[model samples]
Target: MKKKTTIYDIAAKLGLTAATVSRALNNNTKISFNTRKLVLETALEMNYEQNKLALALKSGKSYNVGVIVPRIDSNFFSSVIRGIEEELYPKGYHVIICQTHNQENIENEKINSLVNVQVDGILMSISNANLEANKGLNKLLKNKKTPLVFFDRKKDIKGISSVTIDDFKGGYDATKHLLDQGCKRIAHLSNDRNFEIFRNRYLGYRQALLDNGIEFDESLVIETQSNVQDGRRAARLLLDMEAPPDAIFSSSDFAALGAIQEIKESGFNIPEDMCVVGFSNEPFTRFMELTTISTVDQFPLDMGRKAAQVFLEEVGHTEDVKTTQNIVLTPELIVRRSSSKK
Candidate 1:
């Protein structure tokens, strides 16, 4: 086995003290520019590597952050990740992403694992699973104080910063748009209310209906997962009702796509017979062609950048508990062919 080159070996080769080599490698201003350049060139020639663990111990920073999400397959999450990377890459920090698969236990495990590895911070979007007795929150800083920030799906914990869209407004705008298009009977496909984001969306939907003199019907609302199959099933169930809905306001783009597919398969013309609006302005929402569903744009890329900014701000404070900051971005209701009455 070949032995690894160290600063001590580089120092010996240069006939200089180990401290001088270390200072030059760290780019300390005290070291002269010529000496620093010479040390760097010689170290590269010798294949020298700095011990990251020792540096982390000395500086109290891993220069690595953990980013947890429900899933990366979705366009929204992937775009958000791209934004985070764009902001943090130049800062000499890289992210380690973890997917919770909408499971609370899995989310907790990921937090513990990240903490064990001594990550500098953690950014997450909580899972769909109910967190009545969540252990992940407790396990976050048992060993070390890690900066934590929430993006999109988040909780209202004191001293914890979060960046999210105005979900209530998104829901209200989507529902109100369908109403403006002369949709009398509107059905809502919602998700679990255990999450604040979903609950706010549902509330917005109901508020729009109530404000427009339409009675909010519980039967017209169905709680389903944010997936294509679930959306299709919910659409079918609504269609089978005694008085079928003329429009649908879904909280997920995938679900809205499923409902559109089901509506078309049942020989219905979109906007003519049934109008539809979905959340998350996903990539497919624009190029849906036949469906081209109307959706609320949450600006996920900006959300990720804002979340990274919050993490940076939180990490800057030297105290164990940092001050909280809540940044709520606006949601844009995009008008598309799927919901246009013309």
Candidate 2:
């Protein structure tokens, strides 16, 4: 007796992805005609059957989903999970939360474990660790035929659905607000440029400066991880510069708060002598007793819910019908005492 042929076997023989072979067999227009013809010829040569692996074919569904995040402690990530739970609970789905703590190894382990357990789907916010060479995450998921959705911090790969806010607009709005306050020299505190969200925010900041006739100074842009200590250290460095900025826009709310503390300790008044802005709209940003920080709200809860919705839409559909969708929500700027000089 001979074993049945599978798309994985075909993919391995052709040095291509199983997904590409499946798409070609389904006559997906996205694949080039030459590639499709080659795939069809190979399928006929190998006597391959047309039982394409579909999400609906999976039996004994555990009705469980795994959500991987960098850390669960952040208000943003936690709130997004809360939203995911709220949307999934009514559908008789259980969510297993996994934290990577920004480590790629832990992330890979969690994803592998989830796939082995045959979870129906996975939702994740990718880590910033450079794992492009590995290419294990997407391959594992696709090979397992499990659906994937990304919320918040996501990879920009094709074929994966994602829900996120317009980070560029968020950054632009944050900087524009500070410029509107009549601050001429502004500094930006940013994080790793490898992450699209952080990079977009920084780009937005520079674009805002350029739009307002302010020169883009790389010296004024300090790479801060957006924590309190990082913010304080960054503020100290900016103040020591020959020409210090009177305004600062940070990619992290916690970093912005740290900068505020450092500014005050150094004899600068908020929104008077030095204005500050931050991202993430962390709850503390709006609840300060003396000074509240102004920041951009990424709508993490809504992002989570939308991501769950994307999963629901894709689940139980054939691979031929599972089209990738990208959803971007709008971010709102909440002005407060920190940067609102006017």
Candidate 3:
């Protein structure tokens, strides 16, 4: 393999001291714009790659942000990431993204790794709510070297800022809408047992039924992995019951779409034999004409940008107040052919 380029090599070629080269590379205010430009050009010509770890050790400002999400392919998380980038990029921050695949161990490991790397801050949506270690998490908050922010999928931890939607309200509204459509018997497709968000959703569903004078049937509630196949399987089991559900509320669009496929295959009609409502409002949800109530619109981007902004503020580049803010955006319920009884 070719030798990796270093700042010393660039300094040598440009006839400048290593310290000058480093400061120029870091955009120090003392360096004139022209000198900085020259150093940057020479560094690029020599294929120089700055040692980020060493620089972080010296400056205390990494200019690097870490973002963790349950999964990246989903529309909700990705949008939040995009929002994060939009807010941070202009301020000369770079983001490192890690996906946990909904595993607590993996998520913990990733957070540790980011901490070790000396990232200025972290904006994370946890993989599994059950994986939160208060000791470990509190250490991060108290470190004073790095700040942490949570968005979506956040644990109910005090002193940590989080940006999330009212998941309970979303769930209640989705269920209430189906109930309003005269869905006498309703079922819910829930996610894993470890996720608090899904648990809250299930709670909302039960509460809506109780408020509407509908009996809460434990038999109608199904829990599965947050994926299409699990959704399809859950739908099959529900459909096979002696008395099938009149409506189904899924916490995930992926599962809702999967259930829809299975329902159609089982010779059931949409909105007639069974009404389907999904969450997340993913792109496919609209294309497939599935009724959905999704929270956190392009929220990944907003989450990412806001997280980055927090880091910047923490480091004193900006006077953004360090408030333990809990921002909850309302979710919109989109009605479509799937849920309309008319």
Candidate 4:
């Protein structure tokens, strides 16, 4: 195996002390510009690499941040990760991503693993399951004094900061749009009600109905996963009702796609017979051209960037003086062909 070159090797090659080489590498103002330049050149020529772990141990900073998401394949999470990387990479920080698949146990384990590795900070979106029950995981992160930032999905933890959008307003906009399109009975395809995001969306839907003087029908609401199959099943159940809904406000684009497929199969002309709207504005929503599904533009990339900025700010402060922040980005409603009647 080839031997890895170190700062000591570079120092010997340049006839300088290892401390001098290190200071040069770190861009210490104490080192002369000419000496720093020469040390850098020698280090490059000798293929010398600085030990990050050793440096972290000395400075009490790993320069590594952990990001936890429910799933990476989704467009929202992927875009958020990209935004985070764009912001943190320039600041000499490495991001470690972990997916929990919306499982609380997996989320707990990932938090523990990241904490055990002594990561400088953690950014996460809580899963659909109740996070308050996972007190142990929260305690572990708190004990380690690691900065925690939640993006999109969050919990009401005292010390943690969060970056999210107004989901209630998003839901209200979607439902109100459907009502304007002459949708008298609107069905809702919901996810787990345990999380505040989904619950707020459901509340928005209900409030929109009430504000419009439309009687809220409990039968029109169906619980579903954020997938096509569950969406199809939910739609079928709604269709089987004696008075089926004239529109559907789904919490997921994937579910909306499934509902669209089932609706078409049942001989319903979209926008004429039934209108639909979905959340998140997933990529597939545009490709299908199913309906002008009014969706919430969560500004995932911005969310990620803001989350990284929060981490940077918190990490710079002393543990005792750290302050929590809750940044809420405005969600824009993108009206499309699926939900537009006029």
Each candidate's number of clashing pairs is 0, 0, 14, 6
Off by over 4 Å in 3: 1-59, 131-144, 289-300, 317-321
User: 132-186, model 2: which lDDT tens digit per residue?
Assistant: 7425485665584888898877777779899998999999999999889999899
Every candidate's lDDT:
0.89, 0.87, 0.78, 0.87
Question: Least lDDT summed over 10 consecutive residues: which range in candidate 2?
Answer: 51-60
lDDT (Cα, tens digit) per residue for candidate 3, span 220-252? 999877688988999999999999999999888
Candidate 2 global lDDT: 0.87
**Against the hidden reference, what TM-scores do the models get?**
0.85, 0.81, 0.78, 0.86
Model 1, global lDDT: 0.89
Model 4 poorest ten-residue lDDT run: 128-137
Q: Estimate the lDDT of model 4.
A: 0.87
**lDDT score of residue 61 within candidate 2:** 66
Best model number under lDDT: 1
Per-residue lDDT of candidate 4, residues 14-128 (tens digit): 8889899889987687999999888878877888767888889889988899999999999999999999999998566899999999777888889989888988889999884
Instruction: Report the lDDT of model 3 for residue 282.
Output: 80
Each model's Cα RMSD: 4.3, 13.5, 5.2, 3.8
TM-score of candidate 2 relative to the true fold:
0.81
Best by TM-score: 4
TM-score of 1: 0.85
| Candidate 4: segments with Cα more than 4 A from true spot | 1-50, 141-144, 289-292
Ranking of all predicted structures according to TM-score, beginning with the best and ending with the worst: 4, 1, 2, 3
